[model samples]
Target: MDPVGYSHDEKGVSKEPQHVISEGDHGADTELRRLLSTRHLTMIALGSSIGMGLWLGSGESLSSGGPAGIFIGYVLAGSMIWSVSHSIGEMAVMYPLPSAFVQWTGKFVDPSAAFALGWAYWFSYCITIANELQGIVTVLSFWTDKVPVAAWITIFLVVIVLINVCAVSVFGEVEVIASSIKFGWIFVVIISMIVISAGGAPNHEAVGFRYWNSSPFTHGFKGFLNVLPTCIFAMSGSENSGLVAAETANPRKSVPRAIGSIWLRLSLFYLLGSLMVTINVSPYNPDIFGGSGTNASPFVIAYREAGLQPLAHIMNAVIFISVLSTGSISGYGGSRTTMGLAHLGMAPRQFARADKTGRPWLGLLVTLVLGGGLAYLNVNNSASNVFTWFSNLTSLFTLFGWGMICFSHIRMRYTWKLQGRDVAELPWKSWTYPYAAWWGLIWCMVLMVVEFYLAVWPLGKPSSAKTFFANYVSVIAILVLYFGARLYYRGPWWVDASTIDLDAHRRFYADKDPEAKKTGFKAKTSKTLGFIFN
Candidate 1:
């Protein structure tokens, strides 16, 4: 019997527990659906990543890093993400599945990794949903200061619950529409700002680098690092992607096609977007963000400051859409993570249950309850700071997950080489390996260290001490829950490799005639779409 990737239910009881794929709970009526298209997956990656981070939080990065500093961060982070995307792309082509990451973590590494990494990664999604809930409430305040944040939180939770309960294709369609709105709004914002800054307006005579000269980033290196908390926070949803693997139509093509260009997409979204914004808007007054007055989308700020008409309200509505898009995505991501954890046995069995539509109904419910409860915190006076506390604490965990991805790729590379595999034949290869992986690991480590110091330093920085301690506490708590549970059950380290079927995954790749028989509802719809498209 294998330790985890393919083991029995009774706590690894048998010496040779059947090594066959457990007629997985979710894919019962079908040979696990292959539903996503490259176009759908690519849009998903773009949509999931290019949101609230840019529309809502780019200002923070601009103010902190300046145009140059922010670009540096995005380019660096984007490069590392590129390596990750390629690594994922290669494996995704080889064996695409719904819970591909979870399966891969278990198969290539160990069950303990699958349990720990999956759960921790899932927890990040959960925490982010709470954070986004807070954002929605904050944005809604623009229209109505009278309604309590808690009420808005409930409203958004209901929206997410309804969406989650819908059929999977409905979920996919919502994603498509939501992504369209976000990308559309961001493009509009960037273009409008660039034009406003270039032409002379009524009162402000063509503000050209005025803000940059006025600010000139006098804060130095440490200050640059200091404001990076949100910069990191902005890019949080990239990993939110693996959640959709179970639903992707053709895992091999779709996952790679979707996950492959992370670097380029994020660069344009984060790097190019920030440059336009910083050059257009005031750098970082902290006064413009939310305190008083119109609190314009900084793009609107740049425009109106240049004597443009009241564009702030328009941008506000756009931001509302962006938040809704991101919040919905956040919920979907959290629910999938919960489902993955349950299916993998790290969570309660009930949480793994899905409705007839393959919706993880219980998982979605739990995420709602948790996310809703967190939103209730918005009514508290300290809600804003608490939001910061949670937001600041998350990047380290993201760094860890990415680092594991790099490690997993290294392991996969070793395994591939061990079997005398040819690099040229691989679908996608991570560049300058040993080099790229090492550099990425170093970058991830540096971010962690800087973040750790930011959390603990007590250098008279207010949020650092508590944030550091709390972040560590959450990580430790996650570790304890995963390893402690594993030890209590006394699970073995490795499973019979043969039991972990890569054949089903390979079949999807091998079959030239993709128009095969219907597997289930998801497959039928996907097949219909493929027939139409192909």
Candidate 2:
């Protein structure tokens, strides 16, 4: 390694840091300042997590599991996500980087895990971005059905790409704007739903929790379990906030606060949002779902029930912003993940190149353009099939990433004890370890098993068709391609710690704030207060 610590590009590419092609070679890629604040991080986390899913799919989940069932499902999954967020928060503070999980998986687990998780996550976000851009055309169809989805999709692709390509702060600003619109729509819908349900409307009497109590299907443990995946998916933005960890000035502070915001997102946004949807309209009605149109969102349906004209138009606008913010973040995520993979020798090295704004320009644009193409192609036919494939596969890889995070924490905890370290030294400790991680794994495993069964038999009935794969033949195809590449490359299943880079990290991330020049402010403050009291 050179004295400055940056490894030279193998192909003798640009000597510039931004153009560095390899990782495990410590270096800086851009002159971009770390500018994101706690507030930005928090909103970014919420914005990325709150997707079109809540607006689009909650009705189906509610239908499967009644009001109580839906609530229980979200509460349960949100609780687990909270635990995972904290676990991630604790580690993130110690090692903030754009390749957040990639570093951890490589350093703590193995290079292979990092590579696999990074690529899988990258693909997932790519799919999500594609889906989001595709949605814009569908939403705009409310105004003029004559316009082609492809044309609008191309237009939006350019707009979002320009915003992202400008600068990190610019991207952050645009995301916040989009997020505000999303939040505003959800809040208004929720409040309006409450007003309508409380004997405020002529046809509707005070429902007063009647919708939660009544459902076509039996509501109980069975129902709650059924809606669990949807709930988890709604709160799915757990990994995004940390995507900026490396780019922020004080990730140590911003990331934890962003992590804290998960609770707020779940409690205030998701919970209230679901409650509003359930109360305004009953989930059991066939009118709510199983519809002829792509406008199957529960929020829009409730707004219609409350006598809102141009119901599709209103919700469509809200969803448009939601899709934009989410897809932008997803593109960011895919680029960073690619950079991480390139660093780990899992992918070719050009992806590590960054622009003057510290953004992975080529990487982000590639994912965006590719995702846009896939989404626009689906304009001829409904893209539900593509959406489903991306969602399930992405969730699968995410579950794997979660497992690695928990396991890495477990090892860190042990290493600390062995080195005579104290738990108090950590900036944040996981709410409950081993237990939380184990139970999460168990829960995910159960869900995976059920999904497999549902995929094979479908709704509990046996199917003998060899072609039937729950219509997930596409996912299988991707998996085969991925594993087949692994076989072809003879990729190592395990990584050696010695082969990994373990340099002293930036102080902000490792929680050894150089500016403070003091350790344990909380501890010091407590001791001084105790002395005074004594």
Candidate 3:
């Protein structure tokens, strides 16, 4: 009997047993279903990422980095994300598990690292849920100070929880609708900025490159570096697509397509959006630092300055929707990640339980409790203070998660070669390869350190001890979790390269007809649209 291969049973058993992790092995009775399509996966990434970070946080980045600095910061951050996404995409297509990186780290790196990364990643997403909930109230306050912040937070908390408890298909449908609105809103804003820059608005001021020339780099290089954290937060959700790979149908096809489209999305939505904001709004606007509300949004400021009060109000409404969409996505991701930890035996078995609808109800309940409680902080703390604390905390954990992904991928590649596996057999392969993985790992670590420094010693002035602690607390927490898990597990510092199992749990399906071809304009047009959109 082979230890790693299937063998016949004694009682005249026939056919090979599936070479994948079974629910019983993990002490669970059910598993998540593959119901998400390509469109759902794509929109999950877009909807999760294009939230308060861009709609609200960009103003802070622009104020610090200036127009050119902000643009450059996003480009640099986008490149780093590209590297991270490609690395994870390769492994995800092969494994296709929820919170796949956690399992990948356990297999290819070290079990301790996996435990730490899983919990840290879960914490990041949980905080993100809270942060987006806070964003709801902040954005709504633009229209009315009538409602208390706590009331709005409670309202959104219930809404997000309800969305997560439903079937994943329902969640996907909501995301598709919300993401479409977000995309359309961005398109309108970008076009409006172009028109305003061309002196088409009532202002009739040709603002072409005017802000850039006046203040290309605010506060100098330090300022440029300052905005990187904000940009990272904005780009954090790029990995949500890969996280959903396990639940996505045809992951081999859909996952890669979704990951590949990230570069385009970042360019079109983030870089272009930043460019438009820089052209239409000045960094010196008092509202640029409007302290955690819709008015702080550069888009809103630009529209109002152009005397388009109605348009500004509409943009505010769109932002509120975006925040809600992102909050819901965060809850979904966080719940799944918690379940993945349980699947790996790092958490209680109940956490791994799924309802008939394939919803991780226990995980969802836990995430809701934590996130909702955190959202209440917004009621007492200043919005800006709450936002900064949550943003900084999430950014640290996110960077750490990216580092683990890159490191795990590098180890996986080495083991793949050791096992004599053909590269061509991989469902997806990262084009940048060894270089990209190394680049991503190094940069993510560097940014993590820089963020810690910035937290302690902010650019302009000395931060209070409480503020500094809030900013750097994530770093300490992760370190403690890693070492604590190591002590308990007592696993090897690193897994042996030759012992890595690349074939376990790989989804096997019948081969498709490679020679089949499509013809006609409708087919060709459909293919073209899929290429562009996916």
| Candidate 2 lDDT by residue in tens digits, 153-262 | 88888877787777788887787777767766766776677777896754566776787655634455555554655565566666776667666666565776677667
For residue 435, model 2's alpha carbon misses the true position, in angstroms, by 3.6
Greater lDDT among 1 and 3 belongs to 3
Every model's TM-score: 0.83, 0.81, 0.92
Q: Mind giving the per-residue lDDT tens digits that candidate 3 earns over 1-534?
A: 111122345753221234554321221113787778888887776666899888888888888889998899889888888889898889887777777888778768877788888898888888888998988887887778899888999988999988888898999999989988988788899888899899898888888999999999888988888888888888887778767888876776777777867776788889999999999888877776443334458888898888788998999999988989988888887888888787667888788878766788888888888988888898887766677778888888888888888998999888888889888887668888999889889999999888877877887877778767778888888889889887876745777786555666665434532212556886678767875665
What is the alpha-carbon RMSD of candidate 2 to the true structure?
A: 6.7
Q: Among all windows of ten consecutive residues in candidate 2, which has the lowest summed lDDT?
A: 14-23
List runs of model 1 lying over 4 Å from the truth: 1-5, 8-33, 202-204, 214-218, 260-264, 290-296, 382-384, 422-435, 458-467, 482-486, 489-508, 512-534
Candidate 2 has an lDDT of 0.63
User: Model 1: per-residue lDDT, tens digit, 1-534?
Assistant: 233233354654333222222222233122233344556566677777655556656555565556556656666767776666666666655544445566566656666777777777666666777777777776666567898777788888788777767777776778777776766666776677667676645664566677667764635666566556566667767765555655665555466557655755675677777777767766555534433344435655665566655666676676776667666776777676666566555677676666666777776777767766766766774444555555665665677677776766667777666666677766555455777766667777788778766666522357654456765555675577567657754556654443443333332334443434556787889865753342
RMSD to native, candidate 1: 5.7
lDDT score for candidate 1 against the true structure: 0.62
Candidate 1 matches the true fold with a TM-score of 0.83
RMSD of each: 5.7, 6.7, 4.6
> Which residue pairs show collisions in model 3?
none
